[model samples]
Target: MDVFHVTDKDGNKITNEKVIDYIQQSLGTNACLLPSLRRTVGVKAASKHTAIELTGTDRPGLLSEVFAVLTDLKCNVVGAEVWTHNMRVASVVYVTDDSTGAPVDNPERLSMIKVQLCNVLKGDNDKRVAKTVVSTGVTHTERRLHQMMFADRDYERVHNGLLESRDDKFRPLVTLQNCVEKGYSVINIKSKDRSKLLFDTVCTLTDMQYVVFHGTVDSDGPDAFQEYYIRHMDGCPVNSEAERQRIIHCLEAAIERRVSEGLRLELCSGDRTGFLSDVTRIFRENGLSVTRAEVSTRADKAVGVFYVTDAAGNPVHAKTIEAVRGEIGQTILQVKESYSKSPSEETGGRFSFGNILKSTSERFLYNLGLTKSLP
Candidate 1:
């Protein structure tokens, strides 16, 4: 017999007997022997803000318009994640009542919000219907984004021929084969690796009603290789060519959704209600379209990171960036290094623009009641 040891984060050994007992308690007496029948505990963090889920055709200035609508309705955005892929945009925004600093629970207000946001999402040329939903519950934002895009069928290649024009390096290579003896569909993926690449791929598979029985993920330098042996929920391997194609498409879409394209712009300024709206508007007016955005508020300061490109989904001209930066106050909005850098290389002192933007513009916004008073 070989010896095995288990330990907590602090490295103190957990006795083998205790580990077995814990496993038994977790599985219960009548638990099935198959790994697929096992249950894992999940702990959800409590949140005091209502979440708004939005999905629609993506366009320049769309996010700005969304934020402006929320600001007008007296909603304060505390956190948000925005992703745009293949002309489709999906986001989960967490917000609270500006006056109460609590979740927006009024049915009437929520109804009005839904109507207004739905209108914003449905532009003049959007043939597919846009959707907006408000819920007062804690959810994994990233996972929800994946589900939203999948349901919207963003994996379907756009008719504009943009997918065919992508650089070879950015495109992921995915192959699927059936293993006759094991009764499993084996998927192999090779792509440039970044943070959350595994989570994105695995999450897509799970949401597609597939079970991953075995897998291997290996990273060599910047590239990653993944292989998964999976079966459908009905215990079937991929049976048809169409199903196989869809699985490949979805996995490719999942990997591409989080790839931050274009230049990375980091903004640090005093938190205000209409701050994001104004900044995004500047980008839109300057012919820049945001591809991905992250918004967060820490105390009285607001920090935003945006990946942006030209409205045509190409690299922005240098002069355009300079002009936009000048208009938005060069100190408040600074261009960061490329998003492709590894986490270790990107680490440095943030907030180098000292004093956190206590300028006249901030005071003006505050005077107009756009600034929230933190308790």
Candidate 2:
């Protein structure tokens, strides 16, 4: 391996040890998590990178779900590792912004990201009896009551012939200690461990533009522990006690609401041309954003997993989910003998940066209040 040495004007040889220390001190904070160590949301304590870890009970469809959340949050996955041992799953991922490809730095934004992830984990909790009552075709009022309980974690339903649910013994927690003299912020996170929890937290931080330098993570059943040494974009440790408190508060609240709402829709239809386009049209017309999607075909059947939210980026309300499903059922039935070809469809063959820009621009416009009813 070749080594590059730092030099002064006189070309004095600088000890490599001093340079390595500066690199660790000045480079972004940790991005990966080690068991029994700290916890965090996103990567390197630097501006454009971060290191992170997530651990939870392992299950089928876990990896895909994590990516789905990342796609929904608009975080770009640059590198990742997925491993499962015994009944637990651990993932280490490096993420960046979808648009700017930079670290996420805004606090309010990062909090929301972690919260969404926690909700995903909530959906995976074995003790939760409701388990998305809205998806089970229950009464509107009943669903409402149950969802509230989920969000508040105050109600429990019976499983089997006995009451099998219990309150969360471990409340969610997130903390960051500024180690500026050492040049990093130590971030710790404790929440319900679930699949993709790591990605969601890390992606959130990436969106906020913070970086991770060093991190460690471990899980015991449903509770997860993580630690991260981080830095801000300007390479400074968090200096305010108020700021630290705010960080803790936001993560606590975010974890509470993570899976208390939102709908995960699965659709299976007879395959035909242009089906995806029609589905997306339904999403746009109904003010839905397809946060994540997986589509596949087996024999004559087409199956898809859709992680969705309203245009405002909150979970799709119960009323809206119902209405959208009804519309989707009708649209799939109206599938054409062949896919409806469009201008872009015909132009397919290679990736186009222009098309990417156009799509992003459309979302930006919509976020600024675009409407189908608009002229």
Candidate 3:
């Protein structure tokens, strides 16, 4: 928790000095730090569906850009803690935004948004200077518990069973397609059959809810895989974590059951990169067996719905739609509801699942550290 502090000409304590310092350093100044010097700042923001907490080195004018990114994501800042010590500064920012939570189940999509925010800090749009990603995937048992939690049922406490089910893990995609309003006919083809055809189909399908007016694609195969995008809205789903998880599980079950039938063209889009590999590893890591899989992808993003039957797939849940949705379904629902309330809002940039991640590159940021230094 760090921030910058300042004073007016009259000598009255103005803003926190560290927050100002961090802002200056982030603007391309030397943010190098000494061992003993540390600055801390804490920011707390809460909306109906999301929360943000940011902490790091202290500098000047940092709040402006931080707020800008939040503004861009339409996040509301609720609280903050700022501090600095010996030229070092740190801040913890709290925010809540359902839009950022739109594709919470898609790893690449979530990673991309975070990476974009980090890039805004690094002062670079170029691919080279991107930020890294730190993630914690969930387990299948965890996902199931999450589903139960957000189920909107009377027995709200059962969601806590996730702790006992700590061993069940899975990597499954869960697409929340409400076909009730928007009647998309593209369900006739496999996601891999026609990339553009399937994408347009999925976008239109979500649009049926009327809550989703904007959509984009992020998969490498514009001609092969499925499309992943975020829908913007005003409010968020319920604030209950239990309800959130339950809804996710339901969505995952629904999407997986729908697509696996082969009759459902909703194939997991994106490329066949390390995503499948990671899913497999998680399955193996948790002692789960991947009985079978219809895996495919077109870019760095990928989709591999495995018929996994064990804990090995648990941690990989984050990589799969099941886990993401299971963990944060209520928030996603809120975003949908918010959009439904205001049908007149302006649309932002549209992206595919892969483009969203590629737009920011948060997933690749960590890999960049292992990469050779640029010339």
Candidate 4:
């Protein structure tokens, strides 16, 4: 509960007092912590589907709750992506009509979905509450990771539950073809649709700074087949064989990771300044990438969920995940254990935030940390 952090004028977390003192004496002041705010949900029409955007203070289970509301509305998520900076988060999800298998077009249904999301985001008792995710003797960090795996009720169904139910001799199938006449590249990916399949694939392309002009996602039961028409930032098709293979490799790897039974990381701790940054840094430093993440706060405990993968953009096996778990857990333990050990430090391990980070590295790191201490 005693989370203190120092911030330079640019909002960077200062590890030593010398930096903080200099900032204060020469540059004035900056932010030290992130305060929670009431949730805000925005919706729009995208292509032929519904695009829903959410923004608010960061909290554990937030992503799960958002998808839960969509499920209740009988909406099928075709694409979704989320980013958390500091404690502020913004996410966009593309959904379609569950029964019709087409983009949502009814205004009434969209409005209802929006209203229900507001209720859940605001923690309104009148609507419904997600069952509290708890465990016997489970630490806060594990709790956050568990939310990504178990998440809210219906999470498995929501994510299409392809991880556990796959062909006995199944393998990811990926191919890329150029449609020069259309001036775009057609990438066909076939894989068991795990949680965030669309998000992960699309996020990878977007992360590469490519533009997706058109795409289609379809799933028969747990297996999903998706095709995307993409081009480089300059609108050039990816014609090089090596480049196409690279894209396929990264996407195929991501899709396969979704089913890697143990690809979940949880963080349960008191919310603190620069929480997201510190946690995600572990992922980056370890060559891990977060495909999906959800965060929320309950009873002063930060509960977060993340689906992660290794350097090749595939989920790590058990051994690698263990190392990732240890590094992150120790980092958080250091924060909490330092509360009493570092009294002279005004802010134990706090950082600052401004605009949504534009760089890939900062984007990778800005989107994540949380522990007992301020940093």
TM-score of each: 0.78, 0.32, 0.21, 0.31
Per-residue C-alpha lDDT of model 1 across residues 13-128, encoded as one tens digit per residue: 44457655765574477653321211111111235777787888899999989889999999988877898888888887778889888878778888888888888888798787
Question: What are the per-model numbers of colliding residue pairs?
Answer: 0, 46, 100, 24
For every candidate, C-alpha RMSD to the true structure in Å: 15.9, 22.6, 26.8, 25.1
Error of 4 at 338 (Å): 35
Better of 1 and 3 by lDDT: 1
Q: Write the per-residue lDDT of candidate 3 for residues 1-375, one digit (tens) a residue.
A: 111122332224436556456545644545432121111111212232222223332233333455555555554433222222211222333343434432233445445546655655445322223234342222121122122222212122233344212212221333343232233211111132111232234423332231322233233333222323222243232234554454344333322211211110112434321233333333344444432223323344333233333332222332443453333242321112111000111111211122222223323322434212322
**True lDDT of residue 370, candidate 3:** 21
- Under the 3 Å rule for N, CA and C atoms, how many clashes does model 3 have? 100
Q: Provide the overall lDDT of each model, using Cα atoms, as 2-decimal numbers.
A: 0.73, 0.46, 0.30, 0.50
**Candidate whose lDDT is highest:** 1
Off by over 4 Å in 4: 1-171, 263-296, 302-375
Instruction: For candidate 4, write residues 230-271 as lDDT tens digits.
Output: 899998999688787677755654444333321556566665
Candidate 3 yields a Cα-based lDDT of: 0.30
lDDT for 21 in candidate 1 is 76
Error of 2 at 316 (Å): 11
Query: Which of the numbered candidates is closest to the native, going by highest TM-score?
Result: 1
Using lDDT as the yardstick, the better of models 1 and 2 is 1
CA shift of 15, model 3, Å:
34
